[model samples]
Target: MKPAPASAPFAGPFALATLSAPDGPPFPALVTPDGRTVDLRTALGDPQLTTRHLLEDWPAVLPRLRSLAHDDTVERGTSAGLRVHAPVEPRQVFQSGANYRQHVIDLHVAHRAPGDDRPEDERRAEAAEIMDRRAREDLPYVFIGLPSALTGPYDEVVLPAWAEQPDWELELAAVIGRPAYRVGVAEALEHVAGYTIANDLTDRAGVFRRDMPQIGTDWLRGKNAPGFTPLGPWLVPAESVADPGALRLVLKLNGETMQDESTKDMIFDVARMVSYISRTARLLPGDLVLTGSPAGNGIHRGRLLRDGDVMDASITGLGTQRTRCVTEVTP
Candidate 1:
C-alpha cells in the first residue's frame, strides 16, 4: 500500500474504517463523523474484528454498536493518520452496464456511421426509448468481477502495455450487509450496509469481442486486470446516507474534471439493482453491487490514459480517492 494524498470529509453520522497504523497490519475501525476512529474490535467487545467478521455479524449486533457510537470513553484518534485499506473483501462483485442514460448516449452519439443521417434529437429519443424498455422489462445488465482485482482507494494502477486505451469510471458502490434472496424492490435498500466510492478502471479497447463478434463483451480480459478497482477510504453507514439517488459523483484526471453528474441520472436506482440481482441467487453480507457511471469518459473526451497519469474521484458524502498510473514493470 502507498500514500494517496486526497482526504475525505465525511458528513455521515457514522462510518466504518478498515485500516492499520502507518506501518502495521490491517484491522477494522469505527470512524466518527468528525474523522476520529476507535478500533472496531474494542468497540464491538471482540478481540478479533476483521472487516468480514464485523459485516457478517452486522445484522445481529448493529443495535449494540449503534449505541456504542455515543460512548465517550472509547479511545479515539484522528482517521487522517491511519493507512486505510479496502473496507471489505466481497464474495461477489456485480457491476451494472448501460445503466446511465447520458453515458450510453455519449457512447452512441460520439461515433456515428459515415452514411448515417439521423438528427441529434432523434438519436437521443431512440436511446431514451431503449432505457425505458429496460426499466419496464426489469432487465439490468449485470456482470461478475473477480474479488482479487480489488485494491485500496489510493493504490497504484499498473497499466498493461497491451492496454492502449485505459479509462476511468467513477461509480457509486452499495455494500450488502445482510443475506437476501428474491427481495422486493420496496425493501431492497434495507439489505445495504453502507456506501463507498469506486474507480472502475477499464481498458476500452478490449470491451468488445472482436475475434468472436457474436460473443459480445469480454469483461474478464478487458476490465479485471489487477488493481482495476480502486475502492474506498471510508464506508458511510447506510442509515447515514438518506438518499443515495441524489448524490453527486465526480472524477478528475490530474486536476481537470472529467465526469460530473448526479445519481438521479441513473436509469435504475440502487434498490432496483439489488432486487434484480437477488432474484437469481443469494446475496452475501459483503457483496458489492456497483451502479453504472455517467458521461464525460476518456472515450468521449478523446483522451485515454497514459503512463504516470493520476486520477482523483469523489462522490458526495461517500469519500474521495487518488490513484497514479504506472506501466506494469514486471512479467
Candidate 2:
C-alpha cells in the first residue's frame, strides 16, 4: 500500500484489502483510514481466512471488524511496500453497459456517420433526448464478465496484440455481502457489503461482429481478456459512503486527466442496477456488480491506449487504481 493521500480514500474508519509481502501468497487484511494495514488472518487468529470468507458472513463478521478497527493493541504494518491484490475473489461479475447518461450520449455523437455534417450541439441534444427516453422506459443493459479478467489495482494491463483499440472504462463496483435473489429496488442496496473501483478495459475493435452484424456486440471478446478489469485498492463499507450516487470518478492517462465525472451522471443508480440483475440471477457474497463508466473513454477522445500508457483511476472513498499498459509479446 502506498502512503495515504492527503484526502482520505474512503470515509470509513477502516476498509478491506488483500495484500501480501514480496513473493508471498495474498491474504485478506484490514486497512486503517490512514493506510496502515492489519493482516486479518493474523488479527483474527484464523490463519486460513480469506476475504471471501469474511464476506460470506459479512453480517456477523462486521461487528468484530468494527471492534478491531479501534483496538490499539493490535500490531500494525505499513502498506508502503506490500503487494496489493484485488480486494476480493468474486465468483460472478455483472457489468452494466451504457449506463452512464453522458457517456452514452458522447458515444452516440462520436459514432455518427462519417459524412454527416450536423452541428456538435445539435447531435449532442439529439443524443441527450434519446438517453432521457431510455432512462424513463428501458431497463439497464448489463453483461457478464469472466472472473479471469480480474487484476490488482497496480498490475500491468497486457494489451493483446490482436486488439487494435484497447480502451478504459473506470467504474464503481458494488460488492455483495448478502445473497440477493429477485430483490426489488427498494431493498437492493441492503445486500451490498461495500463499494470499490474497477477499470473495465475494452477492445473496441472487437465489440461488434463483422462477420454477423445482426448478432450485436460480443462482450466476451471485447472485454474479458485476462487482466482487463483492474479492481480495487480498498472496499469501503456501505454505511460509510453516505451517498453512493454522488461519488466522483476520475481517470488520468499519463498524468493528464481523461475521465472526470460524478456518479450523478449514471442513468441507472446502484440500487436499480443491482435490483435489475437480482431479478434474473442470484447475486452471491463476494460477487461484483460494476456500474458503467462515465464519459471521456479513449474512443470518445480519439486516443486509445498504447504500450506504456499509465492510467490512474479513482472513485471517491473507494481508493485509486494505477495500471500500466504493456503490449503482449508473441512467441
Candidate 3:
C-alpha cells in the first residue's frame, strides 16, 4: 500500500479520529454530522486535545463534543481532510485471550487431542464444561501488550521475514474514560469513553515457547512486533453504541471475507472483561481493553497472511481499516 493522498476526506462513521491535516500537525478531530472536520484542539481551543484528555474529562467534554457534532455550520474545515494516526497513545493495553466462544471451539476442533480418539461431541462437551467453570469462577485470561506496537488504522503492516505464519485478529477495543480499580461489572461500562477497531496481528508460528515449556505462551515475541496493532479509523463515543456487546465485526483478506461474527459470541462481554481486569491493575483513562477477536482467523482456514495481502477490517459503527501486509527486508 502507498501513502495516503494529501486529501483523504474525513467521511466515515468515526465520531472522532486522531488525525493530521495536510501539511499540518496531528490532533484529535471530530467528524460533524454534515461531514466536516473540526480539529478538537482548535474546536476546544486547547493545543493538548487528545484521546487521553477527552477520556479523562469525558463527563464535561461530552456535552461540548456532542454540540459540535450537530452544528456543522460552526466554522469548520470541509477540505481539511486529515490522515489517521493511532487513536490513543495508550500507556497500558490489556488484551483478552480466548474470550470468544466460537473461536475457542474452532481452535479445539482444528487441533484435536492426540491418541484419545474421543468422539467429536465428547470433546466439545468437555470444552463447554471448561468454559462454564472459567466463567463461573470469574477468571478471564488477559495479557499486556506494548504500546510501541501500535500504528494507524490505515497503515501497512510489515511481516518480519522470519515469521512463517502471520495471522490477523480483528477486535473491538474499548477506550477507558475513567480511572478504575476493582470495579464491578455493574459499573464497568461507566469507565468506557468509547470504542474503536483494532487488528491484533500475530505470528502464529511463534505463539508458543517450545524451549521454555513451563513458561507457556510468548505474546511479546509473537504479537508485539512493530505495527502489529493497527488501531482506529475513529473512536465512536460510548453513548453512540446502544449495546457494546451486540456489535458485529467483519474482516476480509484480499477481498475474501475471512471473519464474520458478532460480539454476542464473547465468552465474557466487555463489562465483565473490564471489571475482571480492574481487580488487579489500575486502569487509567485512555488505557485499552481489547475484548478478544471473533472466529474465522487465518489459522482456522488453513491459510496464513503473506506479502501483498490486504486486510479490510471493520466493526459495527466504529469504522473500517485497510491494512496491507508487506515484507520487511532482513538486514
Candidate 4:
C-alpha cells in the first residue's frame, strides 16, 4: 500500500520580529506574541539565534521554529513597534503593465485606442497596437529606485508637493531567496523565499522627475519619488501560502476599500513572469519581483492622491501594510 499522504502543517504558534521603538538599535528585535511586530531581517541576521537559522532552511525548519515561539524567554510586547519597511531590498525592480485583461481594456479605452475604427482605420489601429505592445514587451517594463524609496509597515507615505497625480497600485511582491537564471517555471517557486504586499505609488502630475527627458512616460519619475513605495507587515513564509493564485488581495484608503482583487486575475502568472524575467537578467538572492496590480486604480477616474491620504494593501497570508500620505515642501 502507498504511504498515507502527509498531513498539512500548521504554525499554530510562531514568533515575529518588530522594531524596538524606544531603543532604535538593530541588534535586538522586539517580539510580538500574536505575530504583529516580528522583524524577519533581525531574526534572520542573528547568528546566535536558532529560529533565524531554521528560517534559512524553510519547511525543514518550520515546525521546530513554530515551537520556539512559545518560549517565554523571547521578549514580547503589545505595541511600541516601529513602522514596517519593505521586507527585502532588491537590486532591480520590474513592473508589468496592463497585466490583467480588465486593466488592459480599461487602459485602452482611457486612451481611446488612438484612432477611428473604419475598416482601413481599423487595420491601421490594429497594426499600431501590435507594434506598440511588441515594443514594450520586447523588454519587460523595467525601472530602478533606491532603497530610500522604501517605507516600513506602518510608516507614513509623503506625497511631495510636486506630485499632484499620485495613485496607488496594489501588487504582490515576491522575495527571491536563491539566485536563479533561465530556470523553468516548474522550478521557479523553489527560488522564492516568500511573499509580501507592495504599494507601487505613482505620480501622474509629471513634476516629480522633470529633470530626466524620459520622466513622464514610464516609472522613473512616477515611481521613484521619495516614500513612493510602501511595503510589508509580514514576510510570510512560502509554505504558509496555500495558493498564491487563489488568495484574495485588497487595498484601502482610510478604511474605505478601493481595490479588491484575486491573484487569479494575473495575465502572466507568477512562474511565467519569473521565468521570463530571469532569461534576460540574473535574479539574485534578495531580489524582488512585483507582480502586476488589478483594476480599480485611482488613475482611471482622473483622481489623484492629495495630502493626508492613507493607503493600505494586503495579500492573503502575507498580512496587511498601512501607510499615511502626507504632503510637504521638498527640503
Candidate 5:
C-alpha cells in the first residue's frame, strides 16, 4: 500500500490551533492580523512541536499576537477575524428537509392558518392548536444544489432577478476531513475536520405550486441561486467543541435577532447525519455537508431577503459569519 495517500495534514490539538488566513499555498496561507501565517501549518505538521513550542513560535513570529489569549486569538483571529473563503468550493451541496418538528409545524401552520395578523396570544393559541392536530406524513427530504452558489464571508449574496422571495437559512455545515464508506457513527466525527456556518438561501417562487402545499421544488428553488450559500469565517477544529449537538445557533438580519436556538433542536443530530449522508456518498476531505436549519425562517412570515439585507449567523464555539445582500442581473 502507498500509505493511503498521506491523509492531508492530520495534526494534534496544538497543530489544529495554528490555522491563519492565507496560510496554505497556491492560495495564500491564512494570515493572522499581526502578520503570521507561516507558523500555523508548520506547527501543525512538525512532530517536534508540542503545544508549548507552538505557542513559542507565535510570539517569536509575531510578538504583538503573543499577548492575546489562545482562545481569544483563535476566535478574534482565526474563526471570527480571518477574511474567509467558502468552506469548500465543492461540486455539490446537500440540504436536509423537514429536519425539525418545529419547522414542519411552522410549514403546516403557514400553509393552513388563515391569512391574518393576529394578537400574540392568538398566535400562541393557534400554534398550540396546530401542535395538537399534527401528524407525521412525509419522507425524510434531502436535496442537492450546485457549488457555484457558494460565496465566502464578507462576500455579497447576489439576488437573482427571477427570485421573488429569497430567504435566509442558518445551517451548520461540516467540512469532511477524510474519505470513508459505510463509516460507523462512532467513527463519523473523525471524518469531520471542523464546522462552519452557511446561509441556505431559498427562492420561494419556485417553492410552491399556485396555492398548493409547499413541496420539494419550493425547497430546491429557495435553495439554488447564485451566491446563495454564503459560508465561512473559518473552520473551528472539532476538538474545540465539547459537543457539536449542543451548540447554540443564532441568525440575525441587519443586527436584529431572526433565528435563535440550539443545535440540540435537530431532529437528527450530527453523528446520525454524518453516518447517514456517507452511506450514500463517500465523503472526501473538503466536501461539505450542511446539517439543516431550524425554524423561525423568513418564509414562515411571508417575509424574505431583499437587497441591502445583512445576515449574521453563528454556532457557539464556532465563530460567527456575516454577509451583505446585493441584487445582480440573474444570469
Candidate 6:
C-alpha cells in the first residue's frame, strides 16, 4: 500500500472505512476526526461486522457508532500505514452521466465535427441553453455500474492494453442508508447514509459503438474493467457535511491540478438524482448513487492517462484518494 498523503485530517467528526494489513482480510474500521482508526469488528464485539452491515441498519447503528467515536477507552491506531480499501461493499451502483453544467458544455465544444464552421462561443451558448432546459424538464441520464470494478483509494489501477484513451472522472458518491422506492425529491435525502469520493475511470475509445450507433454506449466494455473505480478513503456521514452542493472537488494528475470544480455546477442536485433513480428502481442500503463528474476530463484537456501516472482525487469533508496507474501486462 502506498503511504498516506500528507493532507488534512478527515474533517468529519467520525467516518467509516475498510482496512487491513498487507496480507490480511479486509475489516471494517472507524476513523476518528484526528485520523486514528479503530477496528470495528473488535470494538463493537461483532467479529463479522462489515461496513455494509452497518449501512443495512444505519438508523439503528449510527448512534452506536457515534458513541464509539467519543469513547476514549477503546484502542485506536494511526491509519497511515494500513491498507485502506473502498469503505463500503456496495451491492448495486448507479451512475449519472453529463450532469455537470460546464462539463457538458465543454464536451460539446471539444467534440465538434471536423470543418464545422460554428464558433466556439456560439456552440457553448447553445449547449448551456440545452443544459438549463435539462435541469428544469428532463430526468437524469443514469446507468448501472458493476461492483467488480471497485478498488481501494490508494491501490494501483491497471490500464487495460485495449483501452486507447483512458480518462479520469472524479465524482461525489451518495451512500444509501434506507430502502427508497418512488420517493419524492424532498424525502430522498432522508435515505442517504453519507458521502464519499469515486474516480469513475472511463475508456473513451469504447464508450460508443461505431457500427451500432443506434445501440449507443457500451458501458460494460468501456467502464467495468477491474479496478476501474477507485473509491473512498472513508465515508463522511451526511450529517457532517453542511452543504453537499457547496463542497469542492479537485483532481490532480501526476501532481498537476486537472479538475477543480464544485457540486454547485451540478444540473441536478443529490436529492433530485436520488429521487429520479428511486422512481424506477428500488434503492437499498449500501447502494451508491454517483452524482456525476465535473469538467476537466482528459478528452477535454487533450491529455489522457499513461503508465506510471498518479491521480490524487478529493472532495471537501470526504477523504482523499491517491491511485497510481500502470499499463496491463499481457502474457
lDDT per model vs. reference: 0.85, 0.91, 0.84, 0.62, 0.62, 0.91
lDDT of 4 by residue, 1-331 (tens): 0111112111223323333344454322323335333343443455344323433455555554454455565434443334334555566666665566455545455444235454545554554475357545643344455656777667777887767678888888776767779998899888776777788887755523445545446566667877788766555666667677887778987788888888887766677777778887787765778887787778776766777877767777666677777887666
lDDT of predicted model 5: 0.62
TM-score of each: 0.93, 0.95, 0.92, 0.76, 0.70, 0.96
Model 4's alpha-carbon lDDT is 0.62
Judging by lDDT, tell me the better candidate of 5 and 6.
6
The C-alpha RMSD of each candidate to the native structure, in angstroms, is 2.2, 2.0, 2.9, 7.9, 10.1, 1.4
Model 2 agreement with the true structure over 97-164: per-residue lDDT tens digits: 98888898888787775588999899989888877887888578899999999999989999999999
Point out where model 2 deviates above 4 Å. 1-7, 113-126
Measured on C-alpha atoms, candidate 2 has an lDDT of 0.91
TM-score for candidate 4: 0.76
TM-score: the better of candidates 2 and 4: 2
**What lDDT tens digits, residue by residue, belong to model 3 across residues 1-331?**
3333322223333377777866877788787534567778877989977777888888899898888877646667742345778888888999998888888877767666447788878877877788788889988899999999999888889998878889999999999989999999999999999899999998887887778767878898889999999998778889888887898899999999999999999989999999999999999999999999888998889999998999999888776888999999888
lDDT tens digits, residues 1-331, model 5?
0001112222122222322244532221333333334333333455344222322233243232233324343423223344446644555566776566566557655655456666655665665454344323222356677787887756778888888878888888876666657887788887776677788888766776666654325555666677788876555556656787887778999898888878877766676677877778776665677877888888886768888988888777556667888888644
lDDT of 6 by residue, 1-331 (tens): 4746545546667999998986888999988867788998998889888898999999998999899899999999877768889999988999999899999998889767558889999999999888888877856889999999999998999999999999999999999999999999999999999999999999988888878878988999889999999999888899988999998999999999999999999999999999999999999899999999999999998999999999999899887889999999999
Which candidate ranks first by TM-score, i.e. highest?
Answer: 6
Off by over 4 Å in 4: 1-18, 27-33, 36-67, 70-81, 112-145, 207-216
